[model samples]
Target: MKVDLFDFDLPQELIALRPVSPRDSARMLVACGDEPFADKSVSDLPSLLQPGDVLVFNDTRVIPAQLDGRRGEAKIGATLHKRIDLRRWQAFVRNAKRLKIGNVVEFPAQVRALAETRHEDGSFTLKFEGEEPVELLLERAGRMPLPPYIAGKRPTDERDKSDYQTIFAREDGAVAAPTAALHFTPQLLEALSERGVQRETLTLHVGAGTFLPVKADDTDDHQMHAEWGRIEPETADRLNAARRNGNRVIAVGTTSLRLLESAADEDGIIQPFADDTSIFITPGHRFRAVDGLMTNFHLPKSTLMMLVSALMGRERMQEAYAHAIAQKYRFYSYGDSSLLIP
Candidate 1:
């Protein structure tokens, strides 16, 4: 399908700049078949689910990945895009036009970085000069890598530290949040538990490509960035059991849904995986793992919209998007959500 097929117009006012005070108070648009989209609060999620349904959540935490540093006498900035090792990373350096491969940069405090190599996309492999682990270095010298549309300065604010992450985040790795899970609070978890709705976890280190606009007019030509992900054997077994029992395996976010779908077989068998996936899911892709998905409103002409369009038919998704716009629903990173039942 052409990338333009997924395009939609969103009024600037509907672009959510901040999250709703109580996360769960955010709106949820429920769409199943031809039934009219029902407007509801995320707090109503428990009632929307069944007792035997299994909800899979991505537990990967967002890191403070943006950093400001200087390449010797020349000032430069970088967003620590992805971890390559304990002391190495792939970074998108600002003011990279003047950077040479061998140039060394110094971060705040005593940290230093040397550009080891450069890639065609203007990204670099940087070697760090510190005993502190990469995670620790980022904590000390980096800022939250908010999307470019957010319009902010070098450092992140206190609100982003909490708002950009999910309440259940434990494993640290993602550059982006699995936003559908963000609305879940401790109280909601307890409610799900008390109601006998089983929960499990998978890990998909969401990459900065999530915010990258699709520059290709032909959807087939777009090359998606590979991101690290893992699905445990235990989670697979539980999901398979749920499927066998005629229960739904509902994915909490597009990231989790992608990981689960990537690990599913043509026979619908769920399997454990620990590797990088560059799976660019578009329409006509058959889904094997998930029965439904809870996801945030995505950007127009984005791969995320394409993924959701694959589940809900393209025309149907377009209609839903129109309804969201008409209702003044939020869009993008910190936005209202939807429950798409396939």
Candidate 2:
């Protein structure tokens, strides 16, 4: 399909600059089957589903991956995309014309990295120059990698350090937050628990690529960036058992949904997986693992929009987005939420 088919005009003022005071206070647009769209609150999620239904969350923590540094007189900006190894990371560099292989970029707090190699897509492999762990180096010199849509409007601050991350954040590596889970809070979790909603976790280090727009004219030409994820055997067994017991396995974010789909076999049985997945979900794709999804409003003509359109039909999602816009709900990473059940 033409990428233009997914395009929609969104008012700039509707884009969210920050989340609501209480995380669960954000508005949620519920789309279930052929039912009329229901406007609700994130706190009301427990009442939206049955007791046995499961909600899978991404526990990958957002690392301080945005770096501003200099190589000689030229200023270089780097957003770490993926972990290549213990000391080396693949990053998207801003001042690429000024950088070359073997040059060291000097960062704040004396943290420095050598530009080891440039990939085919113009990204660079930066190897940190120290015996200390790279995580420590990042803590000293890096800033949270906020999506450009939000960062362009205002600067990232201390508040965003907590706002951008979910309560389930633990295993650290992601450059981008799984924004859907950002609405979750301890109180909300307690309510869901009392309501008997099963919760599970997996890791998918959401990369900077999630913020990239679809430059392809057609969906067939778009290539998704690979992100590392893991699913243990016990988790897979439980998910399968839930499906066997006629329970719905609803993913809390596209990150979790993609990983679940990646782990599922043709028969829809999820297997233990620990690897990179570049699954590009489009309209005609068959969803094997997940029964529903909870995610944030996405950018126009983005791969995420395409993914959601795949779950719901294209026309239905188009209508749903229209409804969201008309209702004046927030948009983007820090925006309101949506519960999509097909």
Candidate 3:
């Protein structure tokens, strides 16, 4: 399908600059099967889901992956995309024309990295120059990698150190937060538990690629960037058992949804997985693992929009988005969320 088919006009003022206080206070748009769209709140999620339904969350923590550096007189900006190894990371760089293989970019706090190689797509392989762990280096010199839509409007601050990370954040690697999970809080978790809504976690290090727009004219031409994810055998087994017991497996975000789909077989049984997944979900795609999804409002003509459109029909999502816009709900990474059930 033409990428233009997914395009929608969004008012610039709707882009969220920060999250709502208490996290769970953000508005939620509920789209269930053929039901009329219902405006709700994140705190009301427990009432929306059934007792046995499982909400799979992406526990991958957002690393302070955005870096500002200089090579000679030229300023360079880097956002770590993926871990190539313990010391080396694949990153998207700004001011690439000033960089070359073997040049070291000097960052704040004496943190530096050598430009080892440049990938075809204009990203660079940056190898940190120190015996200390790269995580420590980032803590000293890096900023949280906020999506450009938000960062373009304001600077990242100390508040983002906590705001951009979810309560479930533990295994650190992701450059971008699984924004949908940003609405979760301890109180909300307690309510969900009391309501008998089961929760599970998996890791999918959401990369900066999630913020990239679809430059392709057609869906077939778009190539999704691979992100590392893991699903243990025990978790997979438990999820399968839930489905067997007639319980629904609802992914809490597209990151979890994609990872689940990547691990599922033709029979819809989720298998243990630990690898990079570049699954590009579009309309007409068959969803095997997840019964529903909870995610943030996406950009126009974005791959995420295409993924949601696949879950709900294209026309249904288009109408839903129209309703969301009309209802004055926030948009983007720090924005409101939607519960999509098909």
Candidate 4:
């Protein structure tokens, strides 16, 4: 399909610069199959579904992955997208034209990395210099990798350190937050528990690729960046059992949805998985794992938009997005929420 078919115009003011005071206070647009779009609050999510439904969440924690460094006289900014090993990472760099294969970029706090390989996507592999694990080094010299939409509008502060992360955050690796789960809070969790909704966790270290626009004229031309994810045997068994028992599996975000689909066989039975996934969901794709999705508003002509359109019908999502825009709901990573059931 033409990428232009997924495009929509959004007003700049509708983009949320910061999250709501209470995370759950954000507005939610409920788009269910054949139902009129319903405007609700994120806190009301517990009331939106049945008791036996399971909610899968991505527990990948956002690392302080943004780095400001200097390659000789040239100023360079790097955002680490994926972890390759203990000492190496794949990063998208600004002022990359000034960098070469073997130049060591000197970052603050004495952190330095040798820019090793250049990727076809214009990203570079940076090998850190030291015995310490890169995770620890990042804590000292790196900053949170905020999406350009929000980060460009205003500078990220101490508040974003917690705001960009979800309560389910445990594993450390993701450069981007699974924005859908950002609306969750302890109180909201308590509410869901009271409503008898079971919870499961998987890990998908969200990369900066999520924010990239679809430069492809057609969907077939887009190449999704691979991100690492994991699903354990126990969790896989429970999800399968829940589905077999007629319970719906509600994916908390696209990250969880993609990982589940990656773990699923053709029969839709989920298996234990631990590997990199570059699943590019588009319209006409068959969804085998999830019954519904809860995610944040996405950018125009983005793969995220294509994913939701694939979940719901394209026309339905367009109408839903129109409704959201007309209602003046927030947009983007720090924006409002949406619950799509199709």
Angstrom error of the Cα, residue 89, model 1: value is: 1.1
Please, what are the lDDT tens digits per residue for candidate 3 over residues 54-105? 9999999999999999999999999999999999999999999999999999
Query: Any runs in candidate 1 off by more than 4 Å, and if so which?
Result: 152-155
Q: What is the lDDT of residue 6 in candidate 3?
A: 96
List pairs with backbone clashes in candidate 3. none
lDDT of each: 0.88, 0.96, 0.96, 0.94
| Ranking, TM-score, top scorer first | 2, 3, 4, 1
TM-score, per-candidate, Cα-based? 0.97, 0.99, 0.99, 0.99
Model 2 per-residue lDDT tens digits across residues 152-271: 989999999999999999999999999999999999999999999999999999999999889999999988889999999999999999999999999999999999999999999999
Q: How much does candidate 1 score in TM-score? A: 0.97
Q: Candidate 1: minimum summed lDDT over ten consecutive residues — where?
A: 147-156
- How far is 171's C-alpha from truth in model 4 (Å)? 0.4
lDDT of 4 by residue, 52-76 (tens): 8999999999999999999999999
**Residue 204 shift from truth in candidate 3, angstroms:** 0.3
